[model samples]
Target: MAPPVEPDALPSPFAGLPGALWLYRFDAAGRAHVLDATQCGIDAVHAPDHWHWLHLDLSDARSAQVAAKLPLPDDARATLLSPDSHVNLQLDEDEAVHGAFVDWAHQRGVDLAVEGQLRGDDGIGWLHFALTPDLLVTARRQALRSVEAARRAVGAGTRADSPVRMLELIAGRFADTVERSGDGLSVRLDRIEDRVLADSIGEERRDLAQLRHQTVRLHRPLTAMRRVLKQFEQRHPAYPEHELLPAVARLNQRFDDLDGDVATLQERARLLQDEVAAKLAERTNRHLYVLSMVTALLLPPSLVAGLFGMNLPGLPFAHSTHGLAFALLLGVASSVVVYLALRRMGVSRST
Candidate 1:
């Protein structure tokens, strides 16, 4: 299992805060520069020619204080501060675009341990965003894969010249995360299929169920995001002709395809579970049938022995010197008759 995340062991950037914060500024040439949040003033964010992206971790108490000081519209501010916000997108009265998206918090092989420790918000997290023409602010209560991806991209000098474009890049990151998850699930399903074909299912049912659950969880958020993206496309205040619009449309379609794939995989897992159950039942029935046939073959012999052993005085061959031998021969003959009769009627054949 992975070691626990110690409170005091966080990296420098996230130290001494309930959550981490990062600031990025874009220059006229579309180059990105990482800035310290403590050093950036409100005037820098409001400059007409400058574009900035701010990411805040809302899990910390101080994040509330930091968020209160930003020049955000009321609805956008509410979204960032509301703990119960769900996956959605909307335009505030001031034309600021605000939305929430779902992301995998503890991705397998990223920070998740092999022994299944380090539970992460039931395998999902929420990221809320408030976007205007020049500024983009994102808030989350937990670590998100897409948010990390955007941070890495910006760190590598990728340009995000507008808030809309920044949102698109983050959405693209989300799509990428889902695509990779789907690919991994496909591999798992292939293994499960092989096990089913070989009739070697042992604990695969539980594994498939787990995979199906994860898929369902992922599907819900992606479906919500798809609807939100559709609404955003229709009502976006940014340039109606922005290239990011088409890109977002395509991204939404990709999410739809991924969601369909997850559904198919879930169905396949369910069928395999049923198949395993049926095979087990068939095996049990065959064993019981064999036992029943054995009992039927022995029934006649048992009856013959029981009758000859009775103490009746007029029983056939009861007083003869060779009575014992006669009775033994009779029992054998009766058993043979029963066995032959059963074979003739195909009662001994396996179904």
Candidate 2:
């Protein structure tokens, strides 16, 4: 029997090697057992029937050192260590599959009380994985929702009979997060729509713009992931016989559907923004028209008062004892006439 893991000698799971986070060995029956670094001997890992998984935090220097010693293929090693690696999947000539994927990371302080409501902004991160028939390695620079969910599932005795199944589970977790985000976005859009209908659009334009940006961010990464999965389905050596191929294909389709939904939502937001602008312009034009009519009505009275106020030698109203009354009457008559003319011309009609 193997020696028991000693708490004093083992490093803390959260703060060890630059990127070494967790390790596990899963047997043929889909049961997982946590393994210490000291237990991951090369001879044991190389056993034809052995299956193991190592999760590392790539931001740690010790993780890089540990990764360099692993039996990963050259391409997989390079991809794992490269900081600029993007979301992609490549099948190496040695039958190894490796790639990076974008995953959602919940922001700190976000309120999770509501089922689909996310506070602040949605966070995004990357997860890299290298897979062989007998081994699976995963690395990340930051914590990811999907990875954590998979870990929790494993601990709960979820069946992951092979490395490929593990990958599928992780992918499915990502899909779930995206789906939830979409649902949240839909709820937000519905509220915005109500505001738009009521003509109470205040800061909703900014809100819609933010939603559009988030959708675009989500769409791009999902598109890349779908393309990678499609390529894997068509070209990877383990195509038809690979039990996980169908799962991969399903994931690809789901992302495609999500891409379409996001695109539609984005377009709807843009349309709503346009409508708000047009309504504002129309309202402004009506206000300006009303102001111009008021100015016209007051023009005649102002001119009349100015003429009478002047100290001209022979002013008609100046010689009359009832000059003030006569002037007031004239101004009122002029204003009424102007108002009538405006109404007749249809300038006062509501749009």
Winning model by lDDT: 2
Query: Using Cα atoms with residue i matched to residue i, what is each candidate's TM-score against the true structure?
Result: 0.79, 0.85
Q: Quote the positional error of residue 264 for candidate 1 in Å.
A: 2.1
Write one digit per residue (lDDT tens) for candidate 1, span 5-63.
98545544423323437887887666788776776654557665788888888877777
TM-score of predicted structure 1: 0.79
lDDT to native, each model: 0.75, 0.78
| Model 2 agreement with the true structure over 1-351: per-residue lDDT tens digits | 999998656644433233557777887788888766554543445555558888888877678776776789989988777775467877776668788888877554443334343334567788888888888889888777778778878988998888888988998878876778778888899899899899997898789889888777777778889888887788865556665577677888898988888788888888988988898888899999889988989998998898889988988778789999999889889999989988999877768
Clashing pairs in model 2?
A: 18-60, 19-57
| Candidate 1 deviant stretches above 4 angstroms | 1-20, 107-122, 234-239, 242-244, 304-332, 344-346
